[model samples]
Target chain A: MKKLSLAEHSVRELNSALHDPQAMDGGTEWYVSDPDGRHALACGLNDELQVTIDGHAGYYCAGMNQHATVVVNGTVGVGVAENMMSGLVRVRGNASQSAGATGHGGLLVIEGNASARCGISMKGIDIVVGGDVGHMSAFMGQAGRLVVCGDAGEAFGDSIYEARLYVRGQVESLGADCIEKPMRDEHREELRGLLAHAGMDFDPSEFRRYGSARELYNFHVDNAGIEQGDSHE
Target chain B: MCGIVGLYLKDPSLEPRLGELFEPMLLAMADRGPDSAGFAIYGDEVPSDQLKFTLQSAEPGYDWEGLVTAMERDLGGQLDWFRNATAVVIKTDSGEERVREWLAGNAPAVSLMSVGHSIEILKGVGHPRLVADRFSLSGMQGSHIIGHTRMATESAVSMEGSHPFTTGLDLCLVHNGSLSNHNRLRLELERQGMTFETENDSEVAAAYLTWKLREGETLTQALESAIQDLDGFYTFTIGTRDGFAVLRDPIACKPAVLAETDAYVAMASEYRALARLPGISGARVWEPEPGRVYVWENAQQASEETGT
Candidate 1:
């Protein structure tokens, strides 16, 4: 296995080097020394490459990613794996704002607390935050699963769509268009799989699932007045 | 574009220490304006004792060196270059009188604007971190700071092209919203020989305000002029060396949230940004009224100057 040291290379050059087919074939494992705790490491990858960031990262690390496995050994900044379409990103420490925002596919597993607006506008990404989440988590979320093992702040799952939210601890409040739902056997099994993959051993039965009630998805002519009431209510 | 942030303590406010924390706060808005970031820190340094000047030529190759040399000969050792650029900055000890004399001597080709000391500016390119690291921004101490985060939709990003542009030494400006009538204003400014550095709408606002100030309009008068002339969904925060002002276009397409406390005043592109400040916990926060020009000297002197 070859090793590519990003100690000297800029973020652009480091990502570009990883994309080269020849560099990938050499079994190169990239690492950074003067990581400078920058953001957007290994972002937008589409190949089956394996990348590892050795230290703390700033915002949007591994964002909009696909077909790659990226691992961060330290804390991550905002929007990790945002809009991801495929592959996996594993964070070993706390994540900042809007982790996994608008991700359409793939999985993001954070081992620590996530800041406000986690999984906002998420499409299909499966996000597992091992610790607490700040306010406005899952805001305007469209689809996917947000699994939280700890407490949630205010406005959890506001304006949720088809996305599922599973929380083991207390929830401050639900946002607009969000309500609790029964976690069926299939959900339990899926949650189990995610836990095992993320190396967590929590019980799925203790978690609660929240999703959209489908009350605000489409406009109805017959219910126009009711919709207006809901708008202000 | 780049992200910009600033804080100010208008008079009668005792939280003058808030100006010391400008760097860390502005760093958070980096994503909005990653192309370049800078702040004009207005400290206890009073503008009354100094002359503040800013210059831009209507023609590109106007003789900046010749103008500087002549101003130096006139003002002598009383002159200080607070900031030197392809344009220029020269402070005269004679205050506004020396500045007016110098301006009166220059040709119409050498467009210049000067005012009482009250403005400061900081700028550079790249992400907020890059700009902060390059400038060691966190250490700055000032009475206020204003900033912008750029996405570069309209102009090629560069240090000169970046914003928080000054009309005079005392007044600095930052913008977030886009202007629709930029082309028309750009043409007008161009025909007037305001050699524009970039195709950014923000630049038009800067030049237009400068032109208005050159025409002897006060800060408030110049802003009212902007409300009349500039079109589009724009929001801007203007910081003079002594005071600060906010304006939103009639449509209010952009987001700007302000939080005021006895200690300091803060504003940002989103409520989330303003809510995240450290000492501003529980600060009374609200979005600026659409189409209104909100002015403040600090926490104590805030008022709605205009509205729809």
Candidate 2:
């Protein structure tokens, strides 16, 4: 594996190297040391490569990723794996807001808590948070699946559409149009497979599902406010 | 865009190195804001009822020598004064109203920065590094410090427009986002007899908190009121006599991260500003939740006061 120390190299150089597959032809792999919490590290990657960040990262780490398996051994700042298209991005520690926002594909596994707006406006990404997520998570998310192993913050799944939310813990509140739905066998199987993939021991039976009630998709003159919701749980 | 960084030392052993550690935290945000920079250092308690006030003037031709001696003679109090670049610190046991009347009646051109038992605010219009050097912020020692680097949105790039806005004793606020309801709120606050230093929305935010706290609201309670009354996407760190606090708007569009360890409680616009701090690797790092207040008081002082 290739080794680059952020202390000696700028974050730009690391990203440039990752973008070009030829520079990584030896193995398409890199081990980044001493990240020291820099922003936009390993961003805009589109190749099938293995990149390991050994320490903490700052904003937008591995953002806009495509077909890259990026791993961080320490905590991540805002928007880790934001707008990813494919492959896997995992954080060993906590993540900040907007993780996997507007992402079209791929899987984001955060072993620790993610702050507000995790999986916000998500398109097709699969997100698994091992700990609590802050408020407004999955806001207006159109597609994909979000599985939370711990409690969720206020207004969870606000104004969501299509995306499936599976939480094994308490949800503080639901947002406009979001509602608790019966956990069917299909969703349980999907969530179970995801837990197995993340190497977590969890019982699918302990999880509940939430989604859009589909009442306010279009302007129904009856629904004339922002506090609209039909949550059962 | 704006950048804010704060360091509140939980360990007394790190008190002397406050400025040394805070400089890099402020400078790392050079990209977030390049127009101006500022910091509020809380230290050197007066050990009495006397209050310290930091004042500044933009006119290089302004006379600090004439102003200090004349102000002393005018007030006829035991005034202690000194100069640091364009800033002056005046300490007196006199009341704030008396000093205010004196400044208005005497040095109209000079602007007041802060008034507190221990806090000293120094700010200017320049790059973060240059501003820090110009004000000599690298050598000061304090128990806790709050700073800002500003990219102007609603105000000009003057020293007055720079952040770490202080309106109350031992109270200052640095903001990372704009407020949409500032004009209305400013007018409402003005009706309440609160004067403003600049047209900056952040000043309104600071003043609002100051007003709330002055009316017997705790820092957390005042921030809770802000979450309801203020309309915008903002992340604010407020410096107080006891400690500092972090808060964000309910929507939480603006970015803010906080990390706390046994040694310190630090907050920054991004994790990069906090990466270099001691023991941050093992710190309990997380984003300040939307509409929630996270406050860290000096451990030793709190324990002493509580007799714990």
Candidate 3:
């Protein structure tokens, strides 16, 4: 395992080394220390490397990852793993807002609570939260699955599409066009697979599913004033 | 975007080093808001008979001593004063209304920054580090401090546009978001007899709180009212004589992180500002919920009804 100290190397230098093909040829495992809540640490990685951050990280930590497995032992600021295409980012502590935002494909596991807008506008990324998620989690999510072992905050899955949500605890409120559906065998199997992947040991039957109501998929003339003339006929 | 940082010392031992600890927190947020900076520090309360006024002048080398002498002679009372760069903190036995009138009439260039028994506000237009250094913020001793670094999205870059606006006696507020309905609200507040020092939306928010408090509402209740009346996104950290409170809009578009240790309670726009605090790794760190008021007061000043 190769060790890097953020106190000695700037974030740019460390990421440059991580991004260099020659420098990464001999090492697949890396350890970083003294993160000290610095922004953009080890971001934009494209290799299949396993990196462990020993301390807290600032905003956009491990963002835009392609094939790397990044682990944060401490908390993270806003937008951790934002816009990722593929990879695994695990936050050992709580995460600020917009975690896994707009990720097309990947797996993001937050061992602690995630603040607002977690998995917002996600395309295909799978997110599993061990604790509660704040307001507007998964807002306008397009695809993928989100599992919350703990309670979900206000407006869970607002204006969502295709993305599936499973919550074991209470949801404060549902957003516009979002409603809960019955959990079937297939959903339970999916939840079981996600929980197993996230290293959680909860009963799949204890969760409820939520998704879009499909009412917003088409434009209705009755909702607009253009249909008022037709109503006279 | 702007940055807001606040430190409320729960342990008395950290009082003397408050400024030393807070300077780095403010500097950490310099990138968020580089236009201007300001802070309100609650420290060294005067006797009940005296009131402390924090005054500022646009001129860096204003004649504070002569103004103090003139005020003492005109008000017929002895006044104690301390000067820090362009700002001055004066403790006088005069009434709030009389002192405000005297300053308005006698020293038009000198603006009243705050009026309270313990709060002293200092702000200027410049980089946060330079503003902090000009006011010797690193040497200030206080029980609690609220600071803001402004990027000037809603208003021009000026001293008056800076944050930590005085809400009432020993009460101040620092905001991290914009208010949409400030113009209409400002006019309404003016009709109701509330005066404003700037066209900044944040000042309207401060005045709105001052109005609510004047109408017999507690700080929490006033913030609860703000959730209904105020429009737009915001994460506000308000400093009171006893402690400080934090509130965010229901949508919570603005970011706010809160960490509490046995020694202090710290709130900032981001977690990086709170990273350098002592024992922060073990502190109970969490994000303040949307539209909820979170207040932390000094243990000695905390009453039964104000228990968190």
Best by DockQ: 2
Could you give candidate 1's per-residue lDDT for residues B219-304 as a string of tens digits?
A: 67778889889888678888865668888776455656566776667776643344345555445544465556777753456567
Candidate 2 falls in which docking quality class? medium
Residue-level lDDT tens digits of model 3 in B50-71? 9999999998778888999999
Clashes of each: 29, 0, 0
lDDT of candidate 2 over B190-284, digit per residue (tens):
99888897899999999999899888987767777888889987999988876888888877788888888988889999888998898888898
lDDT of 3 at A70: 96
Q: What local lDDT score does residue A123 receive in model 1, on the 0 to 100 scale?
A: 95
Second chain alone, TM-score for each candidate: 0.75, 0.94, 0.96
Interface RMSD, model 2, angstroms: 1.2
Question: 1 or 3: which has the higher lDDT?
Answer: 3
C-alpha local distance difference test of each model: 0.71, 0.88, 0.90
TM-score of each: 0.53, 0.92, 0.94
Residue A225 miss distance in model 3 (angstroms): 23
TM-score for the first chain in candidate 2 comes to: 0.92
State each model's C-alpha RMSD to the native. 11.0, 5.4, 3.6
TM-score of 3: 0.94
Better of 2 and 3 by DockQ: 2
